[model samples]
Target: MNLKLKEKIRESLSAVLPITGIVLMISIFLIPMELGTIVMFLTGAIMLIVGMGFFQLGAEMSMTPIGEGVGVQISKLKKLITVLLTGLIMGIIITISEPDLQILANQVPSVPNMVLIITVALGVGLFLALALVRIRYKISLSVLLIICYAALILTSFFVPKEFLAVAFDSGGVTTGPMTVPFIMAVGVGLASVRSDKNSADDSFGLVALSSIGPILAVLILGCFYKPTQAAYVLEDVETVVTTQDVARIFARGLPLYAREVLIALLPIIVVFFIFQMLTGRYHKWQIRRIMIGFIYTYIGLVLFLCGANVGFAPVGAYLGKQLAELSFNWILLPLGALIGYYIVKAEPAIQVLNHQVETVTNGAISVKMMDHCMSIGVAASVALAMLRVLTGVSIHWFVIPGYFIALVLSRFVPDIFIGIAFDSGGVASGPMTSTFLLPLSIGVCEALGGNLMTDAFGVVALVALTPLIAIQLMGLVYKLKTGKGTPTERAVIADDCDMIVDLEEDE
Candidate 1:
């Protein structure tokens, strides 16, 4: 247990260091921040590392097992109605509990928070059931994606321009830390039942499909809740001049987040308890471990939210505004790109997705490689987002072409890569992007007098979109590399099964 915790902390350190160092460099050389702000940012970075470590370990211990157990049990049931209903219940429960979704719900002022939350949760439930059906029936992921996205695009025309970016952002944020681990594990559990060679590939794309649902649902809601513009109000960051002030800030924020995290976690815990009572799936020891995991997850989430909202968010906004106000405001593009590249590595959900992908592919796709690809993709997305902020370009100019390219590339990449690529899109836009990057973009947009809804709102969507293209491009390269190989030879090239074994033992 101690070893696993240490490993998680080590992973978080590696992920957090690059971005923290970059931020410090930027503060020193480019945009000079207040000493108080710098202190807060550094403190937040420390909390992020510690919080992510615990959270990832907790997820591995709890969410993965519960999701997989539920999935496997549901798959074994004979009735199709039972399977679909189980999925619907699970999806709604999980989506409602998602911390990222709650952040998003609070941001959009036009819709009531509960109304929007319920709408998005229902969408997740419905589509999650459809995803299950797709897996069972061997439905083609690429074809389903094309059809769903085509419909989403067509619907976008009817949605008010003010709501367009928000609609897409909804999709990206819905598949956050709470949702991703559980949904991906559910896919793995469902796929494990199949004997076919493609079953492993099929264990992905649930996240990809689930992401689309909220976009569609929200877009439909937009038709009715049309607003000329979204009203956004940036919160003021209190100055912190001393270590005591910083401690006070975190202390004040912690209890609020503690309450929020408890509220967020309660429903899921209840669901798990009911499921266990009905099925008796877990042994006594496993239950104890999972309960401990829940405690870790609770503490981690509270610390993470307190640190991120109190410390990182204000700094992100301040940086964006300061950079954009420069004599050469265009520098925000490259700087934003650089920050995006490293910031994604620090996202808790991204780490989970990378580890899962490495495990699923038996290290054919190394976690290092996945991290590199996601970073590049997010870097490009931030560059484009910054460009939009600088030039006041319509988001459609980028998003339409981006998704078109992603969908088109879906035809050429391997099946597993398609799943990983789309899943990566959602994973890439977890809490970090929403809390930090979104505020950063909004700060820039406000400084530049750009429409916040159109220009700033789509950063998360773009963050989600780019990975779809980048990972698939990696897939295309991978495909070409093994094109001439026989089946066994291709298997040998595609997986490091022996190496995976050694790595597991080392762990």
Candidate 2:
């Protein structure tokens, strides 16, 4: 293998191992899972590590370049209408092809899968156009966020209560692995055209704003079509009694996921080719490299989704069922918190966000620090979610207050941190949250006889919420410690340069 692939594998191992070890410890000491289950879980972990390595490499090679190229080309057009139209088209196309959105649509049986998918796609498309406009006009990200969220909360009051959690969740899942790298890179490319001091800060909020679009769209749908109860049918895990059964299980799953991934990627590949043909942007060698990257992405997503859905999800549900049945069910809260702390690291998109943040900041904010902060944020969110399940607390009790605090914090933090915090909220809730954590919550809710829609369904929204506050708080600390010197110094330097230019002109 090449050295770059080796390095990616090593990174994947570090991210995956801790979570696997946590599961093993829980199985041995607390839950005592079946030997067959343990074997299957281990097998899945290996696939996850390998899959993540390839996916990360492919994203760096293909998604980043494609997004940046499109962004730069669109910006160069210098026509607001052209930019808006391009954003709308690209956003809908990409959201339609997101694998996670497909999973989310399947879970919502009230709306036809196609209907939900299209609604969410339209939401993403509209808001993505708004985001590009915001960057072009140098709008205040915090103000935009506050207004959007406030409107979202107000809209929830008119919708059926059952749809609230799902609406918020739509916001979270829309910014999944397929969407994040591409959307973020587009922001970077858009910002690259500007020579302003705040351009870098502006690039960070595209994912954050894109997340909001889904919430608003879903809420509007809720006003029209109300479901009294969510129609969520949990998938049954097939029993595996031996190593051959484990192999058989994965083999059976492989083709299904492979097909799904291929369907998800086809549009993206078509878009890339169209852009290449129209712009002649990439040379033959570069095109060849991108094609190879697409292959890696295809294989990686197939393996990753198969491992997550077939392997990790069943075990998560099983573990939740077992734990909730125990004499002291309250233990789920702390245990969930522990799992959340480690599990965020395993999210492929979280790694992408962390690395991007570090790179954008020129290592001013290290990846390690971002990782630690996200872990704490996610841990708090999960613990709160588990508490809601155990006590039958309404999601609004937590979400309303949680978002209010996050919005308030946005006012105090540096502008860049505000954008990062909101974006992190979306990134922190990725495939692991959907496949593993959502199933786990559903299992516990089922065992506890709680309302699945009201109790278990909002975990993704919560997972997406706490990170906003945690990351902004980190920014607040950095601002306090550093005395906000950078922005201030830049302003002073700009003033001096202006004065010198005037003097030279006068001379």
Q: How much does candidate 2 score in TM-score? A: 0.94
Cα lDDT for residue 37, model 1?
Answer: 85
* lDDT (0 to 1) per candidate: 0.87, 0.86
Distance from true location, Cα of 337 in model 2, Å: 0.7
Instruction: Give the range where candidate 1 is weakest over 10 consecutive residues by summed lDDT.
Output: 496-505
Q: In model 2, which range of ten residues has the least summed lDDT?
A: 496-505
lDDT of 2 by residue, 1-507 (tens): 968878887999999899899899989988887788888898889889999888888888888888888888878877899989989998999899889998888666478788888999999999999999998888899899989999988998998877888788878887898999899999888888878899889889989999999889988888888677777666766778888999999999999999988998999999999999899999999999888888888887888888888889988888888899999889898899999998999898888889889988899878887987898899999999899888888788988899998898788778989989999998888999988998899999999888888788888999999999888777766665566756764454345345333432464
lDDT of 2 at 135: 89
Report the Cα lDDT for residue 139, model 1: 93
- Each model's TM-score? 0.94, 0.94
